[model samples]
Structure formats: structure tokens, C-alpha cells
Target: MSATIKDVAKMAGVAVSTVSYALNNSPKISEETRRKVVRAAEALNFRPSGAARNLKKRKSETIGLFLNDLGGPFYSQVIEGVQEIVASHDYNLIVCSTYGGENSSAHRFLREKFVDGAIIMGTAISDSLILQVASESFPIVVLDRELRGDYVHNVLITNEQGGYDAVAHLIKLGRRNIEFLSGPSAAFDNTQRYEGYKRALLEHDLPVPKRIAMHGRFLEAGGYQAVKLLLASKRLPDAIFAANDEMAIGAIRALHEAGLRVPEDIAIVGFDNINLAPLIRPALSTIGHSKFEVGAIATQLVFNARKEEDVIILPTQLIARQSCGFSGGVSEQDHDNLVASILHVGGRTKH
Candidate 1:
């Protein structure tokens, strides 16, 4: 790894600022100290970054993207889309995870104004913190969360409608006793999806049993455990609607472990048509949206200086596949057709 200024400072037995002064040939530093710093830097093959130096004086011309975790495939397309927009404008992208809430690096980045703007998707960072950091000079675009401020913009999905569609599709497949595999209760998307599930069941005159709703915490492991719990009770629903693809995948694993057949014994549907959805056995039926478009639009809105508050609501689409016993399932060629007719509803911007 390349040596930093701190390494030079430590080698020279001086403060970091002192080493900075010596390297920059400042009058404040003694000749002996300057030579000492230079010799240490040379020994470590250290070189300072001009762009980083310039950041101390003015705008960094970088965009920060904050997320809860960086492990899943869901972030891949979103990051790619953000990078596309960022690279086009000759700007840099810095991705940070807010795993530790305010104590994490994300908070430091926002508080210090190291980046020119931010695109936040993590719920760990509080709304007050975002509001505190955002201004005319530092624009912010948040995903899937609601907040109103002078320079803050929102990009949201039709989560409730997507949830409704998933349940309605199951209903069409003759799945009356449907179970809901929920994500975190605090999550806006989770809450909205749960609402849609209830709405669909009520409209269909089906029993919205509390016992059927299981917490999957939006994780594969969580989904697996949730289904195991239901299996332990010796009462399983005819169908299940997972809030996200990860949980649905996990549930499938659990069902297989129990020697149960998908769709034949219990139908399943999931949200977020991730890349693996089609590859899985009995191709997963899911609620689909343009994750790439969400990231691209959020990046575009980072530079958007609107006089009024801006909230962009993207549309959702239902993908039919064999998992729900809906059809033969989506072929590799039909993956592009995931958007379907629902996309015609179009996205709208609210002020």
C-alpha cells in the first residue's frame, strides 16, 4: 500500500501538521525538520495526492453513497448506475456503510463535508443528521425514506403496490391462506409492503391471520428460520410472499430441506427481481423495478437545484414465473420483459 502523510509524520517523530509544513517547504518548518521529513517520505516511497490537498481548500467534487451493508447482490446494479452518472461528469464516488449508526464513517463523511453531495440509502443515519448536514452547497438525495428539507430530495419505489400485486397474484393462483415473510418493522419499505398484503387479503375476502405473518428481517437466514418455525408448528400456509428476493431464496432452501415441493405444495413469490431470481429452480415470481434507474435518477437529482421539495416515485411491475404456479416461468430472453405493462403507469415527481 502507498504510504500516507501520517506514516511520514510518525517516522520523523513530529505531528502530522508539522510533516505537512515540512513537505510543502513552509517557512514555519526548520531546515533540519524538512530534510528529516523528506528522508522519511523517500524511505517509505510516500507521495502526497494533489486532489486530496485541493479538497482542504474547496469542493471535493465527489459524491458519497451510504448504505447499511455492502455484502448483497442488490447493491451491485445500483452502484454501477451511480458510477455511470458519476463518471460521466468526471466526479468520484465514495461508498460507505452506516453499520454503526452515528459512530460510523458515514456520519464523519457527512459531518466533515468531504464530499460535495450525498446519496443515502441506509436507515442507520437519522433524519436529523441528514437535515443537519444538508444545505444549498451540499445537496442530498435519499432513497426509500421520507424527509423534507431545502436541499433534500427523495427517490421512492411503489412498495405498497408491489406488495399488493404479489399477494393478488398468489390469490389468482388459488392461494387463499397466504403468509407474509416480513422484513424489519422499522423499515419504510417493509411497513408499506405489509400494508399492501393486508389490503390485498381484505379485498379478496381472505382471512388476514396474524399467525401467518412471520419476521424474516429481510435476510436469507432469517427467512430460512421463519419457515422452520412455521414447520415446527405443524401448520403451513398454502403460499408465501417474501418482502425481498433474499428471504424468498432462503425460504425455498428451507422447504427443500423439509422435502416439500415449491408451487406444488406451497406457492411462493418475492419482491425485487434480482439477477439470481431467474436462475433459481422453478424461477421466482417477483415484484420488479428498475434498481439501476433508481440509482441513476438519484445521482442526477444530486445536481438538481429545485426551488421546491422534490420526491420522485418510481413504478413497480409484477414478474410471473413457475414459483407461484402462474405459468411456465420467465425464460432467459424474457428477463428484459420483467418491466411489463405496469411500467406504463410511469414515474412522477412531487413537489
Candidate 2:
């Protein structure tokens, strides 16, 4: 059998309480007694149980990160940033997907206090659940939705501005018949982006024909299916603005299969300058932001000592590429240089 605290106390000829105080480094225990207890524990190969220690102190020294799903290139940089910050602070990170909703392992982790705090990145988990658990003194940082609560904070990107910029870019290129490929209707980012698209259209005196707007579910398959449906109608928009790069890429594939060329027959723009956006055929013009920074900031907020709620909004920038039919009046050499610069920064290369 393994040695316990009692074994250490008996070996050190001290009381069990003294062993506990010494092991925990209590100031009440003298230096001599602490050293003696340490020596006894080493001699007996006694290792304290992490569960017992955490139970006593009510701190797990760990944080949980919840996402909708774990499949995608988009999450790579974000996860890296979160892991870096968590490790720097000497804490462990537990990543879980809340796709299972109430029965998700992440939900159980939160309920059982397996982590000190949590960073949520998806809408699959309800705000009501977050508010209820956070009300009990647990800190939560939500990345997908904004919630007002004493213990709930938000880290979000300027999605509305991104959407406006995309549609406005298409408008500047003389594309009046533009179509919107949207994500899930319930997504906060999707709603914000849709608002921006509408604002830009209204400002430019452009018509937002209801027939041209379609839901893409933020997935490549959704984009492909939506485009196929549009093709069946025998009417194609001059430009398409997908809410995300994945959907944009899907739309590109669907267009190619339909004997149409990007930026020649139909221009396209997307949000979230994902790693593959610039490498795809014709290249994708996109709204760019540092997903790594978003993750880092969210993790930092969860670990912050402040007891008040905080909200952070990260900025976004527009990246023009061939997909938008805007080459910035640059020569072929200059375009090559621009691509090289983007590749250098993103650590990717054309295949």
C-alpha cells in the first residue's frame, strides 16, 4: 500500500495535523518541523493527492474551453493562443465541445467544478445556463454572444463592420446585383454581419432582393447546396458575399462546377481570412483579424482577478485579392510580391 499523511507523521514522530500544516507550508509550522516532515515524505515516497488538495482549497488550477465542434483549420491559431496563455499562467487547459448540449462532457465539468473558470466559444450552450452557473461566483468569458451578468464577460470581433466592408467592396467594383450567403440565423455573428450588409446596401442605394439572399449554415456543404439552388433558378448575382471563408470556398466550387468563373462571371468576398483563403483559385478577398489574439484575450479575461464584468471588441481589416476583381492597379510583379508578403506572414505557400 502507498504511504499516506499518517505514515509521514508517524515516520517524522509528529502529529497528523502537524504533517498537514508542514506539507501545506503553513506559517504556523516552524522551518525545522517542515523540513523534517518533507524528509519523511520523501523517504516514504508519499505523494499528495491532487483531488484531495483541490477539494480542500476549492480551486482546481485549471480552466475549460468550450467550442461548438473541434473540426476546422480556423480553430488552430485560436487554440494555440489559449494554450499559450494558460500554460504561461501555470494552469492546465481542458478543451471540450458542447455539441451534445445538456449532456456534453463540458457541462458536467462546469457543474462539478472541475475547472476554476471557463471560456465559451459557441452558441450551442445556452446563455441561461451560463448566467445561472456564473451567478454562483464562477467566471465565464463568452466569445460568440454578449451577455450582461456580474460574472459573465464577452470577447467579440467587429463582425458588423466586416460584413459592411465586404458588401461595400463589391459595390465599389460596380456589382449592383449582389447576393448574400449567410450562416445560421441564430448565430450572433451572422446577425451582426447581416445588419452590416443591409446597412451598406441601404447606404449605397442598392437593392437587396429577397430572392438572392440564402442561408449557408457557415459550412462548405451549405454553401455548395445554396449555390446549387440558386443555379436551378437560372439567375446568378454579379457578386456573392459569404459570411465565412469556408462557405465562400464552397460557393466557388459550386460556381466552377456550373461552368462559371470567379471575378469574371461572378465576384466573391468572404469573412475570416482563413489560412486557405489566399491559396484557393482566384484567391478570396476577406475580412481579416487575428483569431489568435481573440483566444488569448478570452483566456486572459477568465483568469483576471477582477470581479466585474468586461467586454472586449477586436478590430477587423479588409484584404483585397483577385476574388473581388480588385487588383489595386498593381502589376503582375506587384501582385506576386503581395501574395509573397501574405504567405510570409501566414507561414503558408501556394501548392
Candidate 3:
């Protein structure tokens, strides 16, 4: 009962191949011919198969959001931003996570032509893996990594500066002997943030104690484990700078369980001021990145590439809250913190 390309071609008085070419907007086809073919298809209530169109144009009008994990509150905001942009052009979105590793089902979809472009998240993805993906000649927007190449577009925050600022704030509070809760060693973000922490301590003429640098997986569990380890140690640092909010929250939980009060006992700071940062008791002082803006920016990049435009970068910020010694008005503080965080993280940190 459905009208096919063949029927549309018959109605247009052209070959099926001609219809395909015209529908794909091939340069070889004249504008008049395209107009006529489109009119015919509309009159006949015909629709071309996505696969058939993909075969001709080598595009699927679909973009992928690839990440290492999607098990957090932040990803939802990013998804909303991406959808807000992609929906404007009727483009489809396919979100997949490489839960296992690089060669995951999500990555496989890219290989099989399921999508035309990609927005890749996760710092754990190696440069080699990205280079391999870019070799496919498809446009890709990378989040969380600072990558540069002909086919790769990068949108990241000023991670090191954020790390530096958090530690500096602690020092300003007259808190010395700060501990660092780092993410996975292989993660690019972790490396940058850790470097920033070290830089802050060095600039302030403070000691970078190996015993104070803790390794975490950027998850709540990792934060919990790291804090527990520190608690069992001989001494506790005056402050803890977690690589992300989850880790900060985890550390907070551990501190609470051990009958230690946050800030008053041990101040805390975090990155990725994710949604739950304020909800978690004393709230979390963190570097804020608009997960929504990141998603929107990445989606826009894919669209730009499809339209033959250059790449663009969205910004980041820092939010201060109870977790870092600030108190009262948690919700209002979160809103303002998100804004402040974005500005600072984007290299425009106001006083």
C-alpha cells in the first residue's frame, strides 16, 4: 500500500536511478529536475528508504553520542541539548556507551554506517583509537579530550585552571595539606586536573606529598574507597579535591560515616558540578560544565560538518557551594554556581 521510489520514478517520468540522484540533491542533477522529482514524490505520497538514500549519499542523517558510561545525572542534560539542536533539522540521534571498552557495540554502529557523524565523550578513549575512527573520514566531535586533526573537532574545558582554582581556594581558606582524589590514570581529564593540582601547590610553595595524592575511578565508589584509605592512614588532609562531584560526594559520605564534618573538619571540592552536587548534604564545590551546552555544541559540530562548516567550542565554569565551606540557599547557590563555574572554566573567572 506504500508508494515506493519506483512508483515515484514512474510518476516523474524518469528512471529510478535518476530519482535517487535527484532526491540525494546530487550536483549532477539540475535544480529544475530535483524540483520536479520532489513534486512527483510528494504527489504520489512516496517515501524513500533510509538505507537506499544512505547508499546514494553515503550519509544517514543520524549522529551518534558515544561515551564510556551513561550511568550519571550529567548525561541527561547533554542528551537534552543534543536533541534540542538535532531536532531542529529533523536529524536522528543514537546514544551509545562503550561500557566494556573501545570496540563496543556503540563503536560498531559507527563502522556499519548507522550514523554519519559522532560526538565522542570519555577521556579514557586513546588517541590511537580516535585516530582510527577519524580515518573513516567521517566528521567527529570529541568531548573531554584535547584532540587536533583534519577530521577531529575538540570541545573541552579549562580543566587545569579549574583544578588550580579549587586548590587555591582551599589554600586561601587557610587550609594547607590538601589531598587530591584523582580519576583513572589513563583518563585525559584526570591527568590535566592532577597536573593543575600539582601546579597550584608548587606555585604556593606547598609540598606535593605523594601520600596525599589518591587514585579514584571518578565514581562514588572510587571516592569512597580513596577516602577510606586516607582515613585509615596516619594523617588526614585538611581538604580533598575530587576530580568529579560523584567522587566528592563519596568522600563526604566516608567522612560522615567516620563522624567527621565536611568543611569544618575537612573541606571538599570537585569537578563536573553535576546535578546532584547540591543535593548531597553539604553540597559540592565543583568546576561546572554545561552538560547540555556540551551536547548542543557537539550536535552543532556534526551538523556543521554535514553542512561543510568549521568546528566550534563551547565553554566551562566553576560553582561554589556548602561542600567547600559556603552555606545556605543550596538551590539558588546551585544555579548561580553553575553560571559562575561555566564562566571561570571558560577562562573568564570573575572574583
Q: All candidates: CA RMSD in angstroms?
A: 7.9, 5.2, 4.2
Question: Tens digits of per-residue lDDT for model 2 on 91-147?
Answer: 899999997878998988877768888989889888888877884346899985888
Backbone atom clashes (below 3 Å) for every candidate: 0, 0, 4
Best by lDDT: 1
Candidate with better TM-score, 1 vs 3 = 3
* Tens digits of per-residue lDDT for model 1, 116-220: 899999689889988898887889999989889988999999999999988998888788989999888899998899889999999999988865457888888
- Per-residue lDDT of candidate 3, residues 1-351 (tens digit): 999888988998999888988987889899998998999999988888877766666678787888788887768888898888888988888888877664787768756647877888885456676556563446788877777765677766678888887888788777898999988887878888888889999999999986545777888998998899889985788899998888898999999999999989999999887778878888788877667777777777776664233344444445668877863223445656655665356432211
Provide TM-scores for the models: 0.81, 0.89, 0.84
**Model 2's lDDT to the true fold?**
0.84
**C-alpha lDDT values of all predictions:** 0.86, 0.84, 0.78
Ranking by TM-score: 2, 3, 1
**Which residue ranges in model 3 land beyond 4 Å of their true spot?**
9-14, 18-43, 135-137, 211-213, 306-316, 327-351
- List the pairs of residues colliding in candidate 2: none
TM-score of 3: 0.84
lDDT of 3: 0.78
